[model samples]
Target: MSAVPILGVIEGFYGRPWTPAQRGRLFARMAAWGMNTFLYAPKDDRWHRQLWRDPYPEAEAEALRGLVEDACQHGLQFVYALAPGLDLDWADDGDRRALAEKFVHVQRLGVEHFSLLFDDIPYAVDRAAQAREQVSATHHVMDTLWPDGQAGLLLLCPTEYCGERAAPSVATSPYLKALGEGLRPGVEILWTGPQVVSTEISVQSVREVNEILRRPVMIWDNLHANDFTLHRVNLGPYAGRPLELRGLVAGLLSNPNNQLELNTPGLFSLTDYASGKSDWTPEASLDRALEVWLPAFNTSSIHRVSLDDLRLVSHLLYLPGGLGPQAVRVLDVARALVNPQTGAEEREALVRELRTVRHRVITVLRALEAGPNRDLLFDLHPYLVDVAEELQRLIVWASHRGEDDPEVFSYRGSLADRLMTLGWKT
Candidate 1:
């Protein structure tokens, strides 16, 4: 009914969930940006996945109640997701009841939106049958908790939730076909484009999945998630999807980076995309995001953080397997610095450029430490440490060594640098 509705965030990453204060800040920001939904589905939240059948402790329940109330206050629809796929017995009536009761408890606490996620678990032996069973389970809960189909925005995240993960393919997967055939008329499916962290989601891919699902799928956007690569955090603008994509999907929700503080740029970028920035480009969104986000980097304006510094940092840590324009330029300079036949004058300039990058890393690190925003500093501390460490290695090579030493190539950080040498297994 709400046109191309449900632009939101799903706290569904596999790491420490955001703290209450952090969530409060997010709710406020989401409202300001006109995002309409918030899904609570953090994978490591034991109660959300591991302890799915158990009731939340009084304190936890009260905390969730307050969260839901606050979200509604800000005009954000709060969705509570139950990830019981880890050990669910589709055949068991007791398990079905447990799932329904779990929803009933939270429904009392004011969670109008609910979803059942059957993702990340082992594939069922009979995929088609399993698909049917999963849909039946969702329907059972719907029938038990809110008969007459009055439940708010219901969703399911199938085990094969993306094109890459689907057995054989999305077009031919019996699992998906069965899932589509069995889905209740109003229930929605959550899909993560082609890959778990797809760099691009084309129109054709969406059309294929939509054809199979028999409905417009809701996007569980993972462009900004960094949980898989702990040393990285993506501050890139949401790119890779066509602007016309909004018309193809039922909704789109970002399952972003675990570090809430680092998500400001990414979430804002998604908001602009979802809320209709008619002429959005990742580069432009990134520039706008940097301007808005740079203020947080400044502690007192004395140890100031310039947009240039943030832009550099973001470009370096832009996205998974992606290099920002500046990052690419820096690498090109580095390559030239190490080239054997490069003239001394040009080599000197290349080395200077690298030294400048390292210098900026130190400056940003110092400014971050000078923060009134310790949380942002804490979240970024690991990456800055890694960057600083690598910058040192790069500078050492560019300034002193023109030759590529085998020893120099093995400068992996953390325990890998110490323990895992060139041929440990061999």
Candidate 2:
């Protein structure tokens, strides 16, 4: 039940960054929960990525300075990552100097942890050359600033950050091999498992990368991330990682849901998962997290939501590869209800169960609208409403015994529907 060295949250999504207030609250919570890092690299922060060479404006600098101070006060390590990979010319010395200057400016504000991310960049045919340039560029900046090798928590997210994204494969990728040979001693690497949003991170996979990187890899876990599909949120437990994984890697940092309020269950469950639990089950872990999160759903209005309802909602949003227990049960009934071979008695049972699910979903939607925590309500509304609608569709199909009307959009003035059919996505 040992812990990974870098256990914390990462604010690195492709949308509006969390507010300073939200970040402050996160630092406090992480500090109390035995977590120790917070990576600040929101993609929409122009200064952090698109304008990586530019110094922060005085007002923004002051705000970041204060955030760094707050992180220090809470005993959490603050790491700032620059996504200059979008357009950095690694061969140019001036670009290297700009990188140094940006980090130095933040360093003056008492920031020590730093990372240079090369993910999501344009791929070059000669990936090894790209890897070599990135390694050299990072060294140039580090030599200018932390020549003594005291670069606190230095990290590099290679262009081929995961096995799936790796050119060819992890072991054979020239880019990864170049990084293994070239990264300066003590600089840690950030990997996002086999895929960018991995459903699992096996110990053997970590071992393979470790040998290739010539260092123990630190995971940038994105299991709970939902920025790509904003309509869906993952409010489930920290899972698919075994206790043995703690021994295989340098650290783990979760890049969770973009919506700050929706991440409580994930963040809290992750903390509990790492708190030396010998027998870790995602269900028990989430139940513990929901116990802490249920109060936020208790509106001042008499329409209160319960832990069971939250659990049901979590099932609906659940994991990437598999559904939660309750969700599985619901899907089972729906599937059975649709089967022609199902007995009449079994059909009655299935229909009864689905009606119960329909009732809970409707009641939860009503209670969510009466929320005392308006921000939480706002973040969850779309997903909850969508679930309710899907359940209603299932109920209608059941009532009709599977002979449903064809879905049709009249060609008269419904231009959007016609336009949608013009694309390959349809």
Highest TM-score scorer = 1
Query: What's the count of clashing pairs in each model shown?
Result: 0, 0
Give the lowest summed-lDDT range of ten residues in model 2: 403-412
lDDT of 2 at 337: 75
* Candidate 2 structure lDDT: 0.84
lDDT per model vs. reference? 0.85, 0.84
Error of 1 at 106 (Å): 1.5
Q: At residue 106, what lDDT does model 2 achieve? A: 85
Model 1 agreement with the true structure over 1-426: per-residue lDDT tens digits: 223588999999988889888999999988887789998999988889999999899999999999999999999989999999989996888998899899999888888989999999999788999899898998887887678765588889999999999888999999999999998878989999999999999999999999998999999999999888776899888899988888999998999999998998898888877755667688888888888888888876668878888899888889874988888898788667666788888878877887788788777788889878899888888887777666656666556654444344554566856553343221
lDDT of 2 at 10: 90
TM-score of each: 0.93, 0.91
Error of 1 at 102 (Å): 1.1
